[model samples]
Target: MTAEKEPHLSVARTATSPSAVQVVDLFCGVGGLTRGLEDSGINVVAGLDSDADCEYAYSVNNDARFVHANLLETSSDEIESMWSAGAVRVLVGCAPCQPYSKYSRGTSKEDPSAPVLRFAKYVDDLRPAVVSMENVPAVSRHPAFNGFLETLASAGYHISWETLPASGFGVPQTRKRLVLMASRLAPIALPASNVAKAKTVRQAIGRLVPISAGEANKVDPTHRASALSAVNLERIRNSRPGGTWRDWPDDLRAACHKGESGATFPAVYGRMEWDVPAPTVTTQFFGYGNGRFGHPVQDRAISLREGALLQTFPQDYKFEKAETLRSFALVGRHIGNAVPVALAKQIGNAINSHLEKYI
Candidate 1:
């Protein structure tokens, strides 16, 4: 999957030039949202993230400055330093969602600090002209999340929010995320679903240059899966596409599969269907036993490039240099956690419509 080069624009003296507005990405893991916004003519000036892995990808890929600091600890004065005078500011945040995700249901809410609450504090302090947040749909229902929205409302922002399916916006994955946009200028809405027919797994990765287990593609090395342990290989071979451990032979079942509690969660240790969009790609997509992460047609797990493509990233999106396998993991996590690029582009287009009215 080759990346189509971005169109270069020459300097021009105009009121509506790309440089007129500056976007600050918060919790900007690998700059997925920033890339989409930049593609839509937004000037992405700075990206803030605590993860060291984000530095190279955000800086090199987006050509934006990367600030390595905890978002919860950063002060408004610190944020202001990243902006130029007289530039329209846009605040984009996708706070860490693990605490509020369905995966964390067993965790207690009384846990000392919450990152989402801290993120709202930054919004209150900065009060940028535009604010956009994306997270799991469950976050919208959380009391902490509701309070964040109220804070924005009290600050005079007209807000609109919804839980959107990524497939609706042309991502070839069945991922649903919550998106919010607020502005003092006027009301804002998310972009309407563009893909009636969801993109299938085959459409997304079937044409990729094939590679054997543990072998990277010759043209694009990133499109490669990790080597599987002998036990894991046998486990995957026993799993059927769209089927789970229940479909496995009794002799091959894991010890957990023999228990009653494990019987209830059947989506794990499964393969994806070639005709349908993939199940949500997670950070552990390179592991066959992680969720329904096995490739639809291939015998191994989906490769790094396949995971990015499923997340709506262009084929040639740069990952960290080879020495940093950990950076690759971080990049994969950020990509998996991102609001699909296709969806972000639609959100950008919606904001553009509002901008047109003001301009």
Candidate 2:
């Protein structure tokens, strides 16, 4: 985190009419954080991201402006301009977590220009009243994350951070993430998980009309599965819920599975158990062999809508692009990359509660 000079602007001069809390979601992909905060009664002014593919989904699904601008190129002054004059300004973001993902172990390090570092620029320049960020757990160990916290601390921000399991907050998926919250107004912290038992795969998507492999639901196109090869189709049919490739018959087992090294990847080519929360939904979740994404009873990988539901997006949540192509590759990435709405809502609730004292 390099030192960047704060923009020479008076808060009073730039202030506009205030109603409640106003937020600017940086690196806001498809407006997941915006939607969750909005559901908690916060006013989100806009979403800023570099991907044009996200424009329609962000604008259509949430009542906020979606600006397709790269964060590294966009200055903090331009960003602070979106803040409401009188409202409590909240800056929230979830930088792309690929750099810090466990899967990147052997891969080359993330580029220096990754969004994770760029978002810190806004924090240094604007110094909003409240800030929230979410990222992969691996990030907490990175020097960049430590530098980010140091920047916040030096700026007089009080911060609280935790590695939380999304399932603890009723996300219906065993997705774990690092959530950080900071405030200049007063001391703030995340709320305790209110959900006692984790939501199950069946509880989340049982109501949806079931579909088979390579078929699309007539009512909702997003409720569609990817076409599987004949061999993969047979593999899935022979697979039992919660069981792995170990269950496959000798003839059906892949050559890799017979090797000693195959034991290392036990979760692959497995079906999710109906009574348990799903494994973390990833960008390739639409593929049957990607993690344990297979439908518990249905002989297919979970549908796009089911994947989104596991992420806790609303049933009617609009993905403008899904209407036409219904391309599994495209829609899967959209749904998988999203933050769980339920978990985000809880974070919003914590922020709202933390601010009530100053309000």
Instruction: Predict model 1's lDDT versus the native.
Output: 0.76
Q: Residue 65 error for model 1, in Å?
A: 1.9
Off by over 4 Å in 2: 1-19, 103-113, 321-323
Q: Per-residue alpha-carbon lDDT of model 1 for 1-359, expressed as tens digits?
A: 12322222111122354436777888888878888887777777777888876666676677556778876667888887666766677888788887767644346655423667777787788888788888888887688888888889998889988998989988888888898898877787677898879999998888897776687776676787877787777878887788888877788788888999888878877889989999887777777766888877677888888898888887777775554354446656766776577777777777677766764
Model 2 residue 53 CA deviation (Å) reads 0.4
Q: What TM-score goes with each of the models?
A: 0.89, 0.92
Quality of model 2 by C-alpha lDDT = 0.82
Task: Give the lowest summed-lDDT range of ten residues in model 2.
Answer: 1-10
Which parts of model 1 have CA positions greater than 4 angstroms off? Answer: 1-19, 104-113, 323-328
